[model samples]
Target: MYLGIDIGTSGVKAAVIDEQDRSVAEAAAPLAVSRPRPQWAEQRPQDWWRAVELTLDALAADSPAAMAAVKAIGLSGQMLGVTLLDRADRPLRPALLWNDGRAGAECRELERRFHDFTERVGCRPMPGFPAPKLLWLARHEPAALDRACRVLLAKDYVRLCLTGEAASDRADSSATLLMDTAGGDWDDALLAACGIARTMMPRLVDSAEIAGIVRAELAARWRLPAGTPVAGGGGDNMCAGIGVGAVRSGDAYIGLGTSGVYFVANDRFIPSRFAGMHTHRHAVAALYCQQAVVLSAGASLAWVGGLLRAPDLSSLMAEVEAAELIPAETPVFTPYLGGERTPHDDPTLTATFSGLTHETSPLALVQAVMEGVAMALADGHEALIESGARVGEVRLTGGGARSTLWARLVAAALGIPLRLQPHAQTGPALGAARLARQSVGGPLIAASGSEAIIVPVEPSLREQLLQKRALFRRHLHLSR
Candidate 1:
């Protein structure tokens, strides 16, 4: 058995898979983001470790035999989070997450200093990236910056607890804006620009290579063999691509987790000229992934559900499907709850509910939120195409894949078919497990043969959606 662990924005997941690529057992534990300040998101590094322990413990308790049989472990996590550690490996402060937008000014300053910043980093420096976050700390929280001894991404911190190693995969490192994306190593100039030293970064390795061995005591506690190797896995999107067999150029997938991503695999590094599109290394060597991100996708639905006091997201979506409201009459929503990324790198943007009427119900608002996210994705799709990234049928993965109605809406919005595979929600963890298997002399798993294809909406519905999408774009422009 091979094990995969993913430290996500909302939770930590552990999955165990056998040699045949079948999932043996899985477990997950919830995590909460601390948004103490508006436009700022932080999480205690210890909380990630605690959540990892909870998930692994649950897996060991439920499948002791599989846990014991585990040959190698791999990790995947949210990308670009800044986790600073002191000399003793203790967190200097709460890690700044990818969605945090408090460093907008620092991003501009970095670009102003480095005229070719976008060319070097593969995209313009955004507030969500670690480089800008580090610059922000240097300017506003110099004490923390001065006292830091190491900088680790989200998953690497969990790896430190598991193996006592300070290492990161090249795929994750490339997104930090501190690494030379083409060279696949840390760039001293970039580090110096952010007031970071080369020694502060973790040792980098390929995603499928063994980075370290699990601590004997922790291995025993988790029912794994001593000295089990931990593979240098990758950022969640890279691993998700592996899980869904999107390793080849033109193979694309849409990740609908806490944040939404439209990922297309490439054989070479193709820097995006389109604003907010990211070009980063893939977990697979010699490959790269171009991404157009929506800062909020499933997050928008969750927000509205909480505001309306809905029982849960699934039930709320069910209510939306049952309502069958007319597209023309439904309120239009702009899902910029935490600002946006693709096409417009604006951090000051806010969500809006336009065209609301007295007769509008909670269900209408929920439906509008879903449509708004889809429209946002459509904007990303256009940007990807404009940047010369080719996308055909896209595999839909993440928590939102469970909703067929939403899938159809996204398909309609993108004007492309969406393929849904079994266990689509388990993409990242499964990809991590796949990477672990590869680390232990196994082949990359192929995409499953069984998949449900969601085609675009009918002509009439598509035309109505187009109209609503136009209105959505208009509102976003007016808001800007």
Candidate 2:
């Protein structure tokens, strides 16, 4: 058995898989993000470690035999977080998350300081990237910056607790804007520009390589063998690509989790001139991935559901699906509850609902939010194409993929077929387990036998969504 753990923005998940790649057991624990100040999102590093332990304990209780049989472990997590640590490996403060948008000014300053910033980093500096977050810390919290001895991403902090090692994979490091993406190593000049030292960064490795071994005591506590190797896994996006078999160039997938991502793989680095489109190293060596992000995808739906006091997201979406709503007549929603990334790169943007009438019902409001997310993803798709990235039929992975109605909307909005692969919601965790298997001499990028359900474009719905998209863009422009 191989084990995989994913430290997501919303929760931490642990999965166990057999040698045949079949899932043996899985468990998850919830995590909350603290938005203490406006435009800032933070999570305690210790909270992540506690959550990991909770998940592992649950797995051990249910599948002790499988846990004991675990050969190797792998990790995947949210990328670009800034976790500052002191000399004793204690967190200096709450880690800044990827969706935090408080460093817009720092992003612009970094670009001004480095003329070749985009080319060197493989994309423009954004507020969500770690380098800009470090610059922000240097300006506003100089004491914390000065006292910091190490900086780690979200998953690496958990790894430190598991193995007593400060290490990360190049796929996660490349997104930090502190690494030379094409070189697959840390860039000293960029570190200096952000007031960070080379020694502050963690040692980097390939995603499928063994970075460290689990502590013997902890392994025993978790029912694993002594000195089990831990693989250097990747950022959630890259691992999701691996889960869906999108390792080769031109392979594409759309992720619809807390954030929406349109990912396409390439053999070489191809930085986007378009703002907010990310180009980073793939989990697989010698490969790269281009991504367009919608900062709020499932997040937007969750927000509305909470406002309406809905029982759950699944039931709320069911209500929307049952209602007979016209596409063009619904309110146009700009899902910038936090901010936007792809095509806009505007951290100042906020969510807006236009064309709301007295006749608008709860069902209409929910439908509008769903359509709004699809339209935003459509904008991302167009941006990727404009940047000369070829996107074909995309495999849909994430929580939203379970909703056939939403899948149809996304497919019609993008005007491309979407394949709903088996075990889509488990993409990142499964991918991490796959990497763990590879670390222990398993197959590389192996194909699955399960077939996918395809959602094809509806021409009539596509035309209607296009009209709604035009209105959506107008509202976005007006809000700006």
Candidate 3:
């Protein structure tokens, strides 16, 4: 058996899979993101470790035999987080997360400092990247910066605690705005621009390579086999790609987690310096992936649900789905709740609801929120296309993908067929397990049992949505 763990922004998940790639046990633990200040997202590094331990304990209780039979482990997590560590690998402070915008000024400063920043990093230096976070710390918290001796990404920190090693993979490291992506190494020039040094970065490794062995104490505590090799997995997006079997050129999928991502694989590294899409090494060897990210997906729905005091999103969604599909004179929503990415790349933007009337019902609000997220993803799809990604069909995955109404809306908005792959609800955890399988020289698992559903668009509805999109753009421009 192989064990895989994914440390997500909102939760930690673990799955145990057999040699045949079937999951035998699964567990998860919730996490909370603290917005201590505007545009600042923080999470305790030790909280992540505790969550992982809790998840493992749950898995052990559920399937002790599988946990004990685990031969190897793999990891995946949210990308671009900066986890500062002092000497002896202790966290200096709460991790600066990917969605945090406190480093916006730092991003602009780095852009001004480095002429070839985009070319080397494969994407614009948004506030989400780790390089800017380092610079922000250097400017705002010099004391902590001075004491910090090493930097690690979210999953890398977890790996360090697991195996007593500080290392990272190409996919996660490339997104840091500190990597020479094409060269697959930390770029000295870019590091200098951020006022960071090579020694601060973790040792780089391939995603599926064995980075370290599980420490004896950790293994014994978790009921895992001692000395099990732990694979250098990948970021959540890349691992989800592997989970869904999007390893080859032309393979694509739309992830609908807290953040929506339109991901496409490439046989070679193809970086677009001008476009907003991100190009990073695929977790699979000798391949690359391009992704267009939407900062809010299911988040919008959750926000609206809370505003209406609904118990959960499902009830609101059910009401929306059952409501009549009118001729699109409803409230228009722009889902910029956590700001925008992909084509826009604007961190200061905020969500807005326009065109609400006295006649607007709770159902209309829910529908508008769902449609807003779909429209945002459609914009992301366009951005990916502009980056030269040749998408055929989108395999939709994540919590939002489970909503039939939202899936239909996304499919109609993108004007493409979407396949709902089996076991997609597991998301990154299963992908990590798959990587663990591959790290041990297991055979590649083909994408199987996916049901493709094509939602046809109505001409009238398309025209109405187009008008709404134009209105959205105009409102966005005015808001800026």
Candidate 4:
């Protein structure tokens, strides 16, 4: 059996799979973020470790033999967060998360410092990325920087705690803006641009390479075999792609979690200069992928649910699906609660609900939020196509994928058949498991091909959706 662990923004997940790619057991532990200030998201590194422990304990309770038989471990997590460690591998401060927008000024300074930076890094310096976050720390939290002995990504930090090794994979490092994405290594010039040193970085490795082994103490504590090899693993998004068999060229998937993304794989490195798309190395070695992101997807929905005093997201979504449209008077929502990335790298952007009136019902407002996210995702899909990405179909994954209404909205907006995986919600953790299996010469599972229950475009909603999408864009521009 192979073990795959994904440390996500809101939780930590673990899964055990057999050689045939059958899931033997799976478990997850929920996590909470500390938003002490607006535009800033922080998490305690210890919480990730604790969550991992809880997940492992649950897995052990489910099937101790499967946990013990784990031959290799693979890890995946949220990308672009900075976890500063002291000499003793303790966190210096709360990790700056991928959604944290406190590095906007630093991103601008980075652009001013480096010429042709986007060409080198395959992306512009956005606030959520790690490099600018590090720069922000250097300026605002110099004490933390001075005391730091290593800088690790979210998964790498977990790896250090598990294996006593400090290492990172290319797929995660590619988004740091501290590495040459095309060259697949740290760039000294880029490090200097961020006022950081190369030594601060962990050793880089391939996603499938053996990064380290579970330490004797932790292994004994968790009933895991000592010295069991752990693969370098990948960023959660890349692993999610791998989980759904999106390894080959043009294979793509969309994630609708706290953030939203349209990801497509390619064999060669291709960076966009003006479109604001992100080009990074794939979890699969020698392959690359391009992505367009929506900073807030389900997050916007959650915010609205809280505002309307909805008991939970599921009930809220049900209300949204049943809600009748106002017909030519429906409002448009811009799901930029955490700013945006693709096509607009503005970190200061905030969300808005336009066209709201006394006549608008709570259900209409909920529908606007869902449709807004769909339109945002549609814009990303179109941007990917404009950049020459050949997308046949899209696989929807994440918590948001649970809603039929949202899927239909996205399908109509993007005008593509959207597929839902059997393990759509757990694709990242499953992909992490697949990576662990692949590292040990396991059979490569083919992409879970087209499902019969695809969310196809609704003829009646097509023209109305087009108009709403246009209005969404206009609202985005007006908000900016």
Question: Could you say which candidate leads in lDDT?
Answer: 2
Looking at model 3, residue 28 earns an lDDT score of 91
lDDT of 1 by residue, 36-81 (tens): 9889999999999999999999988899999999999999999999
How much is 456 displaced in model 3, in angstroms?
5.2
Q: What is every candidate's alpha-carbon RMSD to the true fold?
A: 1.2, 1.1, 1.8, 1.8
Error of 3 at 444 (Å): 3.5
TM-score against truth, every candidate: 0.98, 0.98, 0.96, 0.96
| Candidate 3 Cα lDDT to native | 0.83
Expressed as tens digits, the lDDT of each residue in 132-168 for candidate 2 is 9999999999999999999999999999999999999
- Winner by lDDT between candidate 4 and candidate 2: 2
- Supply candidate 1's per-residue lDDT for 72: 95
TM-score of 3: 0.96
What C-alpha lDDT do the candidate models reach, one value each?
A: 0.89, 0.90, 0.83, 0.85
Report the backbone clash tally of model 1. 0
**Tens digit of lDDT per residue, candidate 3, span 128-244?**
889989899989998988898888999999999999999999987888989999889999987776667899889999887889999998788778888899988999999998887
Q: Residue 221 CA error for candidate 4 (Å)?
A: 2.8
Sort order, lDDT high to low: 2, 1, 4, 3
Report the Cα lDDT for candidate 4: 0.85
